[model samples]
Target chain A: MNTNSDYPKRICSTTGFPICRSAEFFVKANAVLGVVFLLIGGIAAILIALTRWQAVHLLPVDWFYRILTLHGINMLIFWILFFEVAILYFVSTTLLKVRLASRLTAWISLVMMFVGAVMVDVTILLGKADVMLSSYLPLLAHPAFYLGIILVAVGTLIAVGNYFATLYIAKKEKTYEGSVPLVVFGATAAAIIAVVTLLHGAVVMVPTFLYSLHLCPQPDPQWYRLLWWGLGHMSQQVNVCAMVAVWYLLAAITTGAKPLNEAVCRSAFVLYILFINLASAHHLLVDPGVSAGWKIWNTSYAMYLAVLASMMHGFTVPASVEVAMRGKGYVRGLFGWLTNAPWRNPGFSAFFLSLLIFGFIGGITGVTLGTQQINIIAHNTLRIPGHFHATVVGGTTLAFMGLTYYVVPLLWRREYILKPLCRLQPYLFGIGILIMSFGMSFAGSMGVSRRSWDIDAGGSIYGPTAHLFLALVGIGGTVAFIALFLYVGLTVGTLLFGRRIAAGKSMEDWGTPKVLSTSPGHDHVAPAPGFAGGATVAEAHPTQGTMVLAVIFLLSFAVYYFANWKALADVWPVR
Target chain B: MNQESSSGLECPKPGWFQAPSGNERTWIGMAVIWCLILSVMMPYWHFRGKQNSTGEAYRVKPADFVKRVEAFVKVNTGEESLVEDGIAPVVPAPPGEVYLLAKQFFWFPVLKLRSGETYRLHISSADVQHGFSLLPMNMNFQIVPGYDHVLTIKPQAPGTYHIVCNEFCGIGHQQMVGKIIVE
Candidate 1:
């Protein structure tokens, strides 16, 4: 161990990963702030949900728009990005066993992020910015709103720079041997995407900020939408990359799973780095100032190479888990490994559940809705939110929560306060988000608009189907809100009051994680002898069940994709 | 203390960079094919299918677009009975070009159209960016302040379709609804 006591680095007693003390402090700070913003966003979510429900229409018109804008920023930008910064720090310094590149830059980034987040919240509450998250041109918000977002973006860019710098130092000092671990590589991919996303934010937001101050002429509306989604949707692509990284990390820590093929996994991440940003075009598919050819080519990501990346991860992640589970002697049927695997461990359950939600619901709907022609049926509707809620909330956020379960125990050296609630939390949250996403998609299919304070404002009744789905949105939102509250309450309570893990001891409530290369007991989980990479390994450990699941996912994608086209055909002829 | 070998926490033991075989390879190939299919479907629809966003747009000032809509409304407004409160004129659009303008809280000049005839429907926002979302049928497009987004369309059924501004403009976004009467 590189026992650099002067720089405050120590090895974790539990997971045996090196813990850079300064990095750990920033991780805790950013995560705590992330949770705080989640609470704020969650409150906004419930209010917006109730108001959209129509029967229980909660907030007044102005408050609805204000809180809607608040919800968009707090949840989408603040909560997710803050947590991502924490992940970047953790993955880089800890995974590579090095000190944080610079504690000063980390602190500067954190303070700027926090201050900017506050400025944004205050400005929105003061009724200065009513433009929605997109904040398309000519619907100007206060200059402070744009400045606040720019600050947050610049801060995130600094953190990403710190991450890269840490990687540089790790390589120079020879912290670890050979290629970086898969998780570190994945984080590198996310950081790369973040750089691109933040640059787009600077390009669009700086001018918009000036325009809000009446200092520059308005950026063209179409031009603004084009550049803004480069920041907006591409940021979600960053989340996808980071979430997949966590999936791999949690899989290894919880189940001793290793990548079946490192080359495949790394190349998939490369696909994301290369082709994912092109997907920003999907947002403008139905809008003007872009041609059909441009929309199709760009929305497809030059033939969906990035989606192929997601599909690759979707299979490899679970197949590795299956191999690990089957090696534990659960090899009965196609799914016996899945059935007998760790369902109780919060980390294991959250990771697996996030995989299912992200792959089955989120990934399927996203590709279908992002189709250039299909977007005509779904653009700016509740379906758009429906698709992303699956990816962002159900997939990314749930995966983060799962990782947090282990992070708290492993990093903070603390046991959970309520063990039972921790186990129940993932299912509750996953199911709630699933229900909510369905409601949004179905209601949207019935011509219900998103971002509206009231759907029935014009006395145009949308019959019973739309009403029923909106009710589902309300019910699902309520369930998710409750689950979110429980998660926050449990997390905070555990941090404050949970028992400390004494040194040289494993987590008692959650079993000691089975480390893959260390334990003689898990020797069976290792790849076949000599790493010969073929039919021998495939025969020894079967992923027939994952193959089955993948088939089901593909089928679902086909049905949903063609169904949207069918629906588009039923509408009036337009070109 | 447990002396742990850095398995996951470190780089994989050397020679871990192996190609995916069997089920994993098959899935990758299938995914690539599905992606190709997804890519092909869009351009196929653009050429062969009726429902496509041609995205035919022209840059016009907000005031210019509003004036064009007013002129179009003035030319078309004749003998059409009031739909409801008559806050907006119920203009009968001929079988050529129709202009619809979206502003803060309302869409101007409720349009009356005939079924089974193509109209080059030009939509633009008078001020901020808004959405030209025709409900029930649920065909939607963007209404930008300076860009006239034209959708060439023919309504198939005779009914009153509500046009709502799905894009967030301001506090009164929910009340921004107009009607398109198809006869």
Candidate 2:
């Protein structure tokens, strides 16, 4: 298999992973297109942010809605899913030491996805599909819009099929010994979720598309929402799984981290695969036609097991990092490992910041807002976007950016052009997103609507405080867009003009930290394989700093969750 | 734990399963408890909390819902001066049934009610789906075109509450605001 010319595999000079040429091409192709869509979406973000800022009110009403539609699809679906497809390819072939199952399938899927994306963008820009991302039924969009989405979903499904095929081949041919790596396991979780999400897309979109063409009766809007969010919100869960995988991969790359306990980590991923799709219920919490029992049961994901999974991942990810850093002899205090972490490495900084923002802000607000009663205060407001921007943009996008910092030199064989700017990119993006999300949440708390072109357009004025928060949205969005521009520009420029790595030479280091001990066994204290049956007590080097942080996170979650309930209580008495 | 090769890229040794220990174990325990608490809160709120989306709704056509809303407005209207938005009627009603219709561009009828009295508000969209986002209070609910969503509400504060169409219904979604006056 290694010597087979048809597959044509090469060893990654830096990471030493096997990178099949066909798989590598697909990864690069998807990533490049992903960045292209990100550019489109980023442009839309600044424009929409300016318009939402009453002081600017940049675009007219129609264009505002139109560009807003484009932004949602491009950012949420195109940018994220395209990159995820790339990740699926990378994890399957690269991590598992196998060739892509079929290059023809990969190419066909990419082409379909590309064409579909273009069609959707054209339909939105032409004002044929002013229906926002959800494309909720009864608010019909052009038939082309539905068809475009169908194409993308089908293409993604094919790509996922290819991923599975590769995985099966890896196992059948004995490409590597034992079970797949933890990162590959996580990617498998994401792929499984994507399959469910895309199937939901088909179930909901096909009928809606037919209805748009006047071939079928209008699908019930309630039913549309119920199924559509299975695609919409469940798709975001795919992003969560992928982002966590990237967190692990980046941690390993940057800090030489390994999973503290493979069983715990793998079990967490299993929870995601089993229960994360139930999270789509959160979107339909306040909607009519869904009963309280149904909403409560689904929204909690059966005793919040999915959330417990997230908390476990959140702990294990950084705990892995803390242990790894401590192994490198940064164990001065409970906080020394964190303080001495590789802040200069954009990969480390971006990964760490994404974890913080996602857990503290996104995860907290999401759980609170998804509470059946609390949705009354949050549904269809800026708070909804506020929560997602932290999760999708801050968490997923930032982590992907961190991966690219290593991926470029490793895959594209090009060094990053601007070193200082590369270092600053994550902080810029993270702070911008933080400010923007906070502004959105606060402004939404004051009843600033999500998709409203003007809050006072109907002659009902939101006070100065709401307007001030809107200003924060504009300011933060501008900064984030600038950072996005910087990242895209650096990536593009590096590919075109940055110094190329000599063939067969190890890639240049991206500022990894110096370790006190060159040895591995002493610092990374774990029960050896011989005692795997029962040596739980033998695992030493406690992640005390991470524990402190976890407690802080839990405390923050409580404060925010309780505060939202209190706010809900203060609202008009309703049943 | 499983041993790794020098490259750190290979799969772990075959039997890699192990229980979480030390801080990891503690965090998992605490997180599980928190999740349980979170799960308990929603149903608890349904039983005891003031605000709960009972999801009391029935299937209805857009036209039927519109006709019902108009009939409610006509029966409740007492003063001509209450009509402030040209076509929109400001209907003051006693504690009982009330109707509010959400369309592409506006919420029909300016609803007026007394504070400290409960009203069964029947909300439905006349055309596409719109959000029934009662402002200042920040309470929101979905208004599907073919459903009569009933919210039994009692206003505690005396003020004019704005109903902003938070859902993207159409081009004029921002201009789609209705008023609820509690006196």
Candidate 3:
């Protein structure tokens, strides 16, 4: 039952609460890195948005394309990856009430990832590659770009290994009892996907890298396309899982409420695990080479189940929110509780707005565009980015920001800096994102293509309508940039300079209580009296090595599938 | 006068003079408003009309056009001096099927009709990459560019439907418009 011993020794000195040095260090390190990534990505998003504005036509064609490519990748890929890594760290340690299994491995992973990210940006800046982020095959990039990506994938693999090791150690030491907590389970699933996805990245990129250096002939486009999807689709699923996990985490932190029905939450995660992979074919719906029947089966029919799962969660989470608010005695219409809810609370506000924005734009467009009839019109257009921003920025990024407000302070044992600003940041960013998404959708409807260098060339296909929409998009980008800057400033300041708060006082004492402790042996663990849930601590925690190994095996399968299929055409014949 | 007096004598029964309850009146008002709105929007449903084409509908077929193109190509190629004339030389459509070329921004079609009609026209790109939109008037279909999208326009109207690429090719994308005149 002495979970405290597993955590670093916390001396209750002048601080009036136990402060674990290791927890504090990890929390602070994550905050700093989170801020840096947010700043870079936010600036890039703003620049891209502003270019759409009327005032800035100054950049030349090639320069503009390069900048836009960097901006898109940075905001979409880099920002999300940075936040997910930090979340992985937090979920493994804080949620499970255990320290990281290996600090050295974690640090090494961070350094390697940082190096890889920098190399990519530098290569992009040097104009060595402008594959426009998607980098579809036949279009090649500089060797540095591929190498950078490989390093990043390897770094993530290492981090996943460390997380699994920590979980194994926790089970060995017997931290808790019975079924893994929902949030941890979801994170573990995401990490499993991440490993599989990254391994695919290695498989695809290693050959591509060699080919670029003339050590091998170019890989066939069809082969590259299929292999890339393994990475692309699976990484997206990781985001999906992580986003959902944050939703549950936020609910616990904000209202001191767990999912009203645990089965629903678990079922949603299960649905994602089973159905998300097949849904990746939606991206290939308009592609010429794929068969009509295969597209229908993989993209359309397969996606419907995942869509249903999302809708289920969409309804369930809000219903839980409503119930929690209703319990607080806001007796009004179904929507009245929303109006009466505390807007000042950053966690509540961000979670609420992010959920709304993502579901309406991201979720709707995703479903519509995934359909065969619609994908023909929407693919490779501005619509693609519009759909993703709705999901990634509005969904995952917002959730990460909201979570940081709690986790940073909780881990660091410091009060949030600029409390008012923290509350304002989410709304500003959320509104800005909504505006940007709307503009992009309008442009797409007008048939504005994505990844274009010059939309207004002499013989260009786009007309005045495209120009107008791009301008509006620029305005939205500017607003988002400012909001993100504010967020980074607030988050970083809170971690380092915010007024310190007492530690023993749970997150609720600061404002609202969002976390739940179901793990036994911890003092704050949820109690189930009279032996119904009681068990020996050792029996409570099961070794997680099997789960970890299972994930690694899945990754290996994906890698082998890609490599073998590319090398030998007949190895995995199409039916 | 008697009728008026009889009607009025029922004491103009001040029908529940109290103002209607807010909730009840609101519900009634909402219902009326919804009904009115639905009625106005209903007419749009039939705007496309009922002139539906069934799968069994008779229309022009591709085989007839192929024969016409082959005859033209054979006759034109036989006379070597025909190519030297100032008149535009006629080229045959490929042996088996229709061949349309879609380039950086243009759709070019070579058409030969069953009635010994030969028409060759140039489709140029206006803005970005656009598909040559070929739709049979009164038929339920469209053909996009970049793929081998061929159609036997019967020259029914002997006019153009204006081929525009649905894909957003670039800035002039909207302006990249082409016309198909079948004669």
Q: Which candidate number maximizes lDDT?
A: 2
**Per-model DockQ:** 0.60, 0.62, 0.02
lDDT of 3 by residue, A80-134 (tens): 6666777777666655556678778878887887788789889988998766665
| lDDT measured at residue A78 in model 2 versus the true structure, 0 to 100 | 99
- DockQ-wise, the better of 1 and 3 is 1
- The residue-by-residue lDDT of candidate 3 on B85-122, one tens digit each, is 23333444433233333333444343332322432222
lDDT per model vs. reference: 0.86, 0.88, 0.57
- For candidate 1 chain A, the 10 contiguous residues with the lowest summed lDDT are A514-523
lDDT of 1 by residue, A267-372 (tens): 9999999998997798888888889889988898898999999999999999988876776666668897787778888898889999999988898889988888
Task: Quote the lDDT for A409 in model 2.
Answer: 91
Model 2 lDDT vs. the true structure? 0.88
User: In candidate 1 chain B, where is summed lDDT lowest over 10 consecutive residues?
Assistant: B1-10
The per-prediction i-RMS, to one decimal, reads 2.7, 2.7, 24.1
Write down the TM-score of every candidate: 0.96, 0.96, 0.71
User: What is the two-chain DockQ of model 2?
Assistant: 0.62
